[model samples]
Target: MALAAVVAVTALLVSYREVALSADGLRSQAAPAVQDVAATRLALLRADWEANWVKENLNGVPAAGESYQSQLSAADQSLSRLAERTSDDLGTINGLLDSYGTSITDGALYYHDDRPIQDQKFREAGSLLIRSDVGLVPRLDKLQNGQMDRAERLATMGALGYTGWVVAELALLVLALTLLSALWVLRDRCGRDYNPWLLSSLVLTVALAVVPLLAMTVTQRHLDNARDKLTAITTVAKQTERETKVDTTDARVRLDGAQTRVSKTSQEVRKELSAHEWQNSVYYGALGGGILVFLLPATGIGRRLNADYWRAR
Candidate 1:
């Protein structure tokens, strides 16, 4: 029983460690990579739209012109790929992209004919684009963020699970102690050779080890599956950003004031991601360490006591 306890405790420790490491990997590295890619994509897409605005409102200079058209084509390809990948929310994004394409097409035609856009018309179309953008793009980004939040929440719950395991282990220890005490009373009462404390301790040891180990294994597996899903979402975001970047570049011209604003907004998003990653990493690390520390004594003492009982009996 004592040996079983030791084994169980060891298993618990290993499980918690794996979960912690995985969380750290996600918060410190994986999550940030995903956010960075998404933010970059958002920035580029906004830039493209801003250029469209500038071409319309600014001195008859079309921001993207032929280059912008080429970029839009690439964007179309990217959006198509995204639609293929995201089987779940394809409809919303596809519709938004279609609307965006139409707007771009109309805006480009107006620019080609050198037709001065009325401020009101520009505002209306711009509002439509904004509606399409905030409606779709941010939601996509939010989905990714939502995964991260879930992971963080799971990690927190895992800690709580660890605490429960600790209590179970302690209970096993107490039970073992009670058994050992009973053995002593038996020997005294019957004039027999029995060590109740030792026998009881053995049971406690097993309980301590088995319960925590099992709980940890199950929880870690859950975390692993969740993290994998998060990673998949990240991959999609990265692919989209890479495709967009292939066709986007900074031009020497101001193009549109809106583009500048988008750049500023993108920068803000980048900063937010950085901060989020840092916060996640720190908290996750602390939780992981706490689990490990809590598990060690609970398992070890029980195992040791059980071993002594077995040897005496």
Candidate 2:
């Protein structure tokens, strides 16, 4: 019974640790990486549209030029942040971005003198950004897809961890039953009253079982919420992309709204994940409690048996 109790405790602690790690990966690594890629795509699309507007208007408007530069800067910053989390080689994408910026700058220089050349330059830059196969936007889409896949896998692992928790609970139930049976046998055969040590172990075991289960339940809830938020952000981003083709002003409005949602949801995810930081301490405490639970039963039964042996001698 002591051995069974120890095993159950170890299993529960291990399972809980797995779940915590999965949540951390999703919150700290995968979700943010996805957001970064999405942001990069949106920024690049807006910049492309602004460059075209500049070419068509030929108004020498400072606002349009500034917007274009601002979007490029935003895309660059997003890519830089993504670099920290991803293992993918970004050398090619960075090179393309540099070339794209140069073409845009060169095209602006020819706006007054050579209209056709300026148009050609802008076309080259646009192709670098949204060309069919080699465009920066599509590449970022592929990267974001990879991040989404990773998040899905982590979520699956968390589900499996919960399954492990169920098994641990079953083991705890069996341990409780065994302890009760031992107490009853001692009372009937040896005319012993309820053993204090065994009684305390039973109570402690029940408490331990309930506490971790409650924690797991709460963790699962937070995980689900974070996932839902990520999904919403992705959907909004896609809609913004589609709408950008129809109206630039409307697209800008949608992009701003999406950015706000992303920012708020990201904060919420971090807060939820931070709640599990204390889990390591809880794990150690539960381990120590399991040892105590085992010891209590062993000490009680050992004393009773020793007393009987001495009486026989």
Candidate number with greatest lDDT: 2
Clash count for candidate 1 is 7
Candidate 2 segments whose C-alpha is farther than 4 A from its true place: 61-64, 109-112, 157-159, 310-313
lDDT of 2 by residue, 1-313 (tens): 9668977888888887787788788878888887888777777777776677676675455555777788889989988998998898888888888898888867864463577888788889988987876888777777777888887776565456767888889888988988899989988977999999899889878977888778767877787777776777677667777787676776556766776776777787677667887767767777787888889999999998898899999
TM-score of each: 0.41, 0.90
Point to the candidate with the largest TM-score. 2
Q: Candidate 1's error at 63, in angstroms?
A: 8.7
Clashing pairs in 1: 176-200, 176-201, 179-196, 180-196, 180-197, 183-196, 198-309
The global Cα lDDT (0 to 1) of model 2 is 0.79
lDDT tens digits by residue: candidate 1, 164-261: 55654664465456455546555786455654335434543554456445545654554455455445545544454445446544422322333344
